[model samples]
Target: MSTAVTRLFIPRDTTALAMGADRLAREIAAEADKRGETVEIIRNGSRGMFWLEPLIEVETPAGRIAYGPVDSQAIDSLFDQGLLQGETSHPLCQGLTEAIPYLQKQQRLTFARAGITDPVSLDDYQQLDGFNGLKKALQMDGQAIVDEVKASGLRGRGGAAFPTGIKWQTVLDAVSPKQQKYIVCNADEGDSGTFADRMVMEADPYMLIEGMTIAGLAVGADQGYIYLRSEYPVAHQILNEAIDKAEAAGFLGDNILDSGKAFHLEVRLGAKAYICGEETSLLESLEGKRGMVRAKPPLPAIVGLFGQPTIVNNVLSLAAVPYILSKGGQAYADYGMGRSLGTLPFQLAGNIKRGGLIELAFGVTLRELLEEYGGGTFTGRPMRAVQVGGPLCAYLPESQWDTPMDYESFQAVGAALGHGGIVVFDDTVDMSAQARFSMEFCVAESCGKCTPCRIGSTRGVEVIDRIRNDEDREANMELLEDLCETMIYGSLCAMGGMTPFPVQSAVKHFPEDFNQPAQTNGAQS
Candidate 1:
């Protein structure tokens, strides 16, 4: 008689870790051992459904069944409930993992392997069609790979929406030794409502490794670095593990796959500077300098990282390359609306029922995400406004919920999709307070490299305070608008350039909030 080993999956993603998944995992293993049962526990990444984290899954003949928000004390009960046999009688039983509506709705191109495979497991990643893109890339020349990315219409997912292929082509075209050129990934995902980058790094680090390898091959660079945010300790550990594993497997470093191609990748922690999210500023931080913005013209594509031509891409943008190369660029291009092609991993945060990640084609309406996926505000109050693309983006009211989640469409509405982060706010939210907070955030986070962002943000906050206190309300309003215009065009980078978005949007959409008496804690009345 053959004894079967029960397979159990637990997430080690940061959110799950914060929810005590590590303790739950150890407890589950202890209980299984105490019961004289054989169990194979695998630590996977979060499913992006954060509310259901510590989500445990068991492999059954039928499929993987899920039970979530599992507590350490519940481990014995789960085992007693025949969890190894995939029993569905437990109160936390969520049935088939894939059937969860929140996950089912996402297109998940860039995040295809997240939450499914063991994070840092080279074997598991390979089994799931992982390096097919790198294999395909190995068979093609540099121009061919760049052309493929261009055909896919992939823009930088870090918020700029600049064509990624064009950036690669610049580095490819620059007159520099292959060794001098570099590939830098901006993993400093500090924006509010954003964790897609963190999830990708923690869940499927190899996908990023493979993608960065492809970028190196295409851009004639053999070295790469991921400037990750220091806040994500879990991601740092997972990425380092994946890198070591990949190097040992010959998928990274020194003659990869014995194909005579060589690429090396490493992770460097950012100084927790929000301005470092900018391409040039990130380059500065990567070189051990203070994180600050650099002037354009000699763009990062021309001079970056050690003053060599570099290809800087966001984590999601690099993560998308494997899919584009494997499935063919046209397949990805066919998914989204005009101009913005391929999938975008939209993060739902703030006051929302289902706050997690949703990767979809670019044209989905905000109303669908808010009403259907998010299920409205977590406070159970009506959603007053939604901030699309982080704190630097505009505060969109309910009236603008129909706007499409695309670069051009968002721009058409006088907003920029800084990053695919949507922060929902309830009716009790004060747009005026939010506007002030935007300036305050900029004030605190600014690199102090430019006057408009460093100084203008301070003045903007004071102006909002005056308006809130009803001191020269009308005149201050006009002055605030003028100041915003200067910051929008005068600031060195998006840190100051985009800070006015929330301020402008607030005054435009919810003027009544500004006129009302200031509430305690500096919130709206």
Candidate 2:
């Protein structure tokens, strides 16, 4: 191995691509050639610190010095500044990539492979502890692997913090399937405040593939499918490439790792429907049907894609599998506090400075996350509420600042550490408008499979309007409360069910907005 090669790390994830990393990479390469530099640039998946996209790292005598959010215009300056030789004088430079507290503090397990190796090069992935878990899993009985996961306390990172071990155990105990058992990755990350899925897919594609392979081996699954959302076009492109590479390298094809496991994988995409983020809706889309959610009781594990025993796990949840398998479950599980286990990949977004992915053990308070890590509101305005979770998640006011970001603790305060996403809203934001938008968003995205979600969402908007219009604001508030109760009790999935949480929280937190007098021009004829 050429250990002395001048290594340059560039992000290739969707967010970085959206921020134009592709053009920047080409510029860096071209500039390197002009300067006669032997630059060995590696297009790795992002470190998930999205605020610093197009982040470039050049191996220096001191260490891997970093530069970020770089555009093509800065490439020439970067070359002139001796970036390949790592002088660290560029305008975009952020010295020592690893030293950034945001990236350093993260307990990166699922993200272990991310930003550490070439995303497409299976060899680089293998060099950095990739596929080792799958190999280790193949050595043991599948049941033993499942038991290890159960012990690790790794839960679903896609909103609901359900124990992964319990889900796997249930699937294992269900049957000794010699049939078409499937492993499905839910990559439909439509939630407004979350991009962890997109980052992982783009930054560490093979890690996800390897994680899926382990899940397949443990669950007797011979086929796997990833239901990627259509909005993540770049992620889809990268994942497709990774899958091909994995197959070529004998990691995802027939007799994968020569363990007699015939696991094959493919990708499916949803048509940008938010409801598709829900597992059932995702399965329906994966099965070549309309992305409508299926009623549960006959859960996806029992009757999943095309009527088979499927292991449907969120992208992060599945990605976290390798870590637990490589270093036993109890070892992974012993990280978090209370019922929450392991590290939470908290996605910080919206109206906040230092917005990016922050993965830490659960129990970090909202106040610390918002005021300290978030660096207050991006607008420099005082913050009013921190919407933890997704759009449906509750808008926790400043009063709830002390609430720790655990599932149960959040639930106690009419909130949730949903998918570990925290979207900050400044005081200037109109809560009534946000509440109305929540209802409107629900109406637009509802799968229409459930009555409350379909009709109640449309009605919720009008009810919110009634409160805003001062048509007996208190009475309208009561009506909206009734509507919330109906939606909470009646909706099929959490999409419609939890929409009320944010709406009501916003209204309760900012009551002045609901009672604001309608501004009318006197000259309106």
Candidate 3:
């Protein structure tokens, strides 16, 4: 490898970019030019440590030294402190990157290469065991590949914790001389507190590409589509560029490394409809139709995109494929507990200190995540409630903080580990208002295809208003509970079905918020 006179690592993730990483990058280059120094700048992804965005790293003989929350204004001072030489005396110096507690604590399986390499560089990706999984997969028959994933105990990282191997097997078995098969990667990551999908697409695009390629080989698919959200412009550009690189490098397209297997991939932008995050709705949107939820019985596995056999997976799920194929399924399964095997990229957001992505094995307690990784609330006040999963997940009170981050554990408490997102709320939050907001959110984002979610949510808002206004308080409360139950069992999809999770959870956990008579805005009951 050619030695650089000096090397700098700055993140281009949307979070970092929003924090002025782009401006800081330009300033660092200008400072180096003025000093007549040769510097190599590499734009890597964030290590999921959000509070320290615009995190700068300098490659040294000892290791990579880090500095964080840096802006253009700090470049001159950082350079003055001999940052290029790896000096740790600067105020912003964070010592070694890996040694950071937040990062060191994470069991980064899917995100192993994130924040560590040039995202689009094929050679850099290959040097880090990137394509080993694809290579191993190429040597195995389709049944062997499917069997390995089945043995891994890998469930969907997407909201539905369905068995991934079973989905692949159905697609594999559905294929015949006349049937076409496809693989779809759900990159429409709209869940609150979730950025794991966008991170993989932007930081290590090749990992996702390799994973999808393996899926193609396993299920007899020749075409794949990544349905990415339009909000992620940076990921869109990076993924498109990565797809081009992969196609040119023979990792994708008609022939795969001269193996005579065809796996062509493309990125399709979502219509910015939250409902499209659901698989059938996403398929409907992909076909140039209005985004609406579809009824089941003809599952997407058997009748998906263009009415063909398909495998629909989340970005995080597909990204894990490379590692599983490389090190064996059992090795990947060894990390977590119970049916929830393997690591999950759990995102910490909202009113939390040190909020970032924390990917760990299943079974970590919520208390540990909220206190240890989150460092409690950002405002330093006592935390009152936390919404695990996403906007529709149950609003867990502090009493339920001991719940483990596993499918069955969460299910036992009438909660879920949907998308592994944890959004915290401080004690000052009003659960009454929050309950109403859940209804409003569901009404706004609902696809109008289901009656329970569409009409029930509007009624839910009215019931909450009645309870807050003390209009037949006990009766309205009963009506509200009845409405939630109806939505949970009657809706066509989670949009209507799961909205009650947050509504009821708030009422169940913080009864005081709904028990009081009407009061002036912002007044404590």
Candidate 4:
């Protein structure tokens, strides 16, 4: 008689690996062998509950039970306490995986398959409705597919908040002389404290593939490219592997599913440039040119990527297409508040406990995420400032924390929910220095193609230094504001345009920081 084999799952995501998951996996196997028991280990993606990384799930009659932050040293104790049988008596046992409050509360539409299956398994992907969107898109006309996206009320999740469907419709309606169009997925996610795009690429790569394939069908594009950041070595490898697997299974490449419709996809590594996160700059980098912003008149939809019409979208926006196609547009439209339909995967990071990804509907307040999901600051100090969006975004005070997280709501408060990267800061943070760093960051990353960004950022830094040093403080403060206006309106791209957001917000919300007494040796208190 054959003995029944026990199944165990450990995450192979970057976070888990950083926490020594591979070592833990080896130890578990050795312990099982010493006991003469049969065990199967499956490396799955992370569930985004980063605090409990290397979370091991044992398949039981009840369900997958969770135990986490597990190390090699704990393997012996865990097994002795009936870990294989999903016993909850162990100190590390977190009960059933699905019942965890952090994971249970998330809507998880785009991230549905994330952490639930093997990252590169095509079978695992198909079993969970992976290519259903592409299957449906193959049957519908291009116009119909575009219409579905329009009705879904989806906007760009890459911080711009532009209507995605309208951009698709533009590409669909554009006339290409060379009969060529492109679908570019901006995977160069350079925003500070953001890892949602990397999580999708590493945890559920096929979702991005399926979403991009549907985009090809919707916009009549035959080729797609994922401009991934060079920093993400793991994501690059996994994306390439998933693409190979998908193509072999007939989900990508020419004559997909034998429908005679063709779509080919490839992954290209980007040069380490923050400016490349901008769509036009990304296109320039893809074309082997200097990554510089292109002026808008003939939008990318009409003229892009070797001068052919192109559809450029963030990874989350494209990843969302699969769901919009599978469950009708209105189905997705039913989730969020007015205009900001569908769920957003908010990535919590910085000085916060319980930091990870939380996908919720639009109307959720920032206070809810910080308090309930974040559980307050990791240092246990009073929370001071919160930077939503990226380095270019404003530093919000406690008063603005109550605002809803949608595009318009954030916009109304002179803030943005850019890429859903929320970075927390404790009371020890120096707001004036942070504001200065924003200008300095622009100086370091600017492409020098525009004067406002290139020169204004350098001057802005000098002015902020003067303010901090108490050198004609009143005159310099006024000069700083005037210079910010120049950069805001005179810059060629958001690189220059949005640099003033953090500096202006710091002076507005935390004036005390800027008005501090001058230090003796440039030392900050």
Candidate 5:
């Protein structure tokens, strides 16, 4: 008689890797061999709960049982506790992986398959309805696919909040001079406190591939490029592997699924420039030029890659297409409130007790995310400020915490939900210094394509330093505000344009912080 092989799942995500998942996996396998046990170890993607990372799961008759925040040293202890039999008595055991409240509450449309299957397994993906969207797309014409997307109420997830269907419609209507259109996935996610894009690429890469394929079919584009950030080496490697596997499995290449349509995809690494996160700068980088923003008149949809029409969409926006096509557009659109349809994968990071990814409908308040999911500050101190979007966004005070997390609500509050990254700060933080850092970040990251972004950021940093030092503080404060105004209206791109958001918000909300001298070392003056 044969015995069933004990199957264990370990995360191969970047966060899990940093938390020693690799070492723990090796230890578990060695311990199993020593005990004469037949164990099959499968490396899966993260569930996005970083607090319980290095999370290991044991496959059982009921379901997959989870244990987490595990270290290599726990391997012996885990085995002795009948981990293979899915024992729950162990201190580390976290019950059924699916039942965990953190995961159970999420409306995981784009990330549905994440952490549940082997990332590179084509067979596993197929069984989980992976290519169903692409299969459906093959049966529909380009107009029908675009119409479905239009009905979904999908907007750009890459900070801009632009209508995604409108952009696609323009590309579909455009007539490329060379008869060549391209689909470009702007994966250069450089915002602070943002890792959702990396999670998608590393955890469920085929979702992105399938999304891009559907986009190609929709826009009559044959070539696609993922302009990925150079910092994510793991994502880059995984994406390439997934692309290759997809081609071999008849999901991509000269003829997809024996259909007459064709789409070829590849990943090109950026030069570590923050500016390339903008669509035009990414196009320039992909064309082997220096990463710099191009002025708009001939939009990328009309004159794009190699002077041909193109469809440029963010990682999250494209990743949502598979779900939209599979379940129908209105089904995906039924989640969020108001015009902000569908769920957004909000990344909770910085000083917080339980920080991870929270995918919810758009109507949820920042207070709910910060308190319920984030569990307040990590230091257990009073939460002071929350910086949504990225470095270029406003540092929101507690009074504004109740604002809903959709595009219009945030905009109405003089803030923009750029990339859904929320960075929390404890009471010890200095808002004046934070305001200064915003200007400094702009000076360092601006591509120098325009004057206001280049020179204004440099002058703004100097003016902020003057105000912090109490050198003509009142005069410098007014001067700083005026300079911020110039940058806001004069800059060519959001890089220079939105630099004032943090600075202006800080001065407006925390006026007392600027009245005193800046903190020295770790002490406030």
Candidate 6:
């Protein structure tokens, strides 16, 4: 009986659960009972490949035979068709899951543990190479851990490419006799076209906990907080539960693993404000206040969160720490080219047909990801502009597709791989409309602290209208450019400053869209 136990993993993300994985689990168990197949099923998170929800795996002679978008009703037919041995008549039988080019091409470093193990199971996590980093860190001094991380060449994966090791060393060097040090994980990823953070949190909560635990040990931080956005209510619930489990098991809380290290962690919820994704705004939210961006110069590393020295990092930044510590920093550092080092968990989202998460090295090009990896736009129409990063990022044309995806590579070409989100749009999409939407999104989500962001965003929309209506189109275009310049150089934070990135990139890439514009039903022209 033990030898016959074939393990199968079922995606249990909220979307999958809603689509009926829970009932399907029961059905699989019952069907195995009638068929006399010794199969053990474990629930895991999506591969960020949402189109394949309720994804089911069957232990087979050839490997795991996957059938997706599956529900309870289909389980009987699956078992009857001998799917356990890889023979299936099910319509959803996507033969040979590993060979699916989209899933196969990804490097899957940070996501190596995802979609493969029970998310909350400590045993499963450890078996799949989880706590090797924390164990390694426990054997080293605080500064040593910081030094190792410094060599990894990992930067903030949230957007800004600040070095994680450098940030930790600052908190370590800070004078805090009467002061307390904090480890804050920025999980408030409000950036559209990005769900890499959310996927990590849900797929492997233990990885995040282990990552944060390592950060706390390195930075002399006893208390840690994960500032998760409220929009990700499902992820918030999953991580919070995992935190409780970890605390009970002595992996978290005081005297962790009897190492005499007093470390405790908590989860702080964000209230759907986009600004909270910023570290200062996140800190403000943690302090029971509105999410407003704070001034810099005295960076968060020096003075932050209840006036204490804080080591704040993005979700992916911390998640990558475990791998860096386990496999020497040089191993992780050697992956990328030039300034951008280590592997990146790139999210292929929006209009793309094969949209999902693709982890790869820094040197890959936009064209490879969009054409080869993405399988073109979802509409099967000619792919128009592709937006790398989130809404604040630029809408670039095919002319820039050959450009590499490294930090300086994208930036040199006037685009960014912000949060590693690649949103594609087909030929039908008008850059002018998307550019206008960028300003509109800013107007809706800005924290209203800075005058330019609070006011300029609304005006930017009006100016975009002047061009869209073709009312002195060329003049309006110049005025819009000037307004963008003001917002870029004048605004306090990225809310207003980066709004120009999408707008100007749109006009630069597709000037024909703004020239002699089309008339809507309500247009005065």
Winner by TM-score? 5
lDDT, candidate 5, residue 82? 84
What would the TM-score be for candidate 2 when compared with the true structure? Answer: 0.95
Clashes of each: 1, 2, 0, 0, 0, 0
Model 5 residue 247 lDDT score: 94
| Predicted structure 5: lDDT | 0.92
Q: In model 3, what lDDT does residue 252 have?
A: 94
Candidate 2 achieves a global lDDT of 0.82
Q: What is the C-alpha local distance difference test score of each model?
A: 0.90, 0.82, 0.90, 0.92, 0.92, 0.85
Q: Which residue runs of candidate 1 sit more than 4 Å off their true CA positions?
A: 1-3, 177-179, 520-525
Q: How well does candidate 6 score on lDDT at residue 497?
A: 81
Query: For residues 139-257, what per-residue lDDT tens digits would candidate 1 score against the true structure?
Result: 99999999999999999999988999999999899977434899999999999889999999999999999999999999889999999999999999999999998999899988999
lDDT of 1 at 157: 93
Residue 440 CA error for candidate 6 (Å)?
0.7
Residue 52 C-alpha lDDT in model 4:
91
Off by over 4 Å in 6: 1-6, 18-23, 26-40, 71-76, 88-91, 519-525
Give the per-residue lDDT digits (tens) of candidate 5, residues 366-392. Answer: 999999889899899989999999998
lDDT of 4 by residue, 1-525 (tens): 333788899888888888889888998998999998889999988999998988999988888999987987788889999988888998889999999999999999999988889999998998999889989999999999999999999999998989999999999999999999999999999998899999999989999999899999998999999999999988998999999999998889899999999999999999799999999999999999999999997899999999999999999999999999999999999999988999999999999998999999998999999999999999899899999999999989999999999988999999989999999999888887888899999999999999999999999999999998889999999999999999999999998999999999999998988887545323255
TM per candidate: 0.97, 0.95, 0.97, 0.97, 0.98, 0.94
What would you estimate as the lDDT of candidate 6?
0.85
lDDT of 1: 0.90
Error of 3 at 445 (Å): 1.1
- In candidate 2, stretches whose alpha carbon ends up further than 4 angstroms from where it belongs are 1-5, 176-178, 518-525
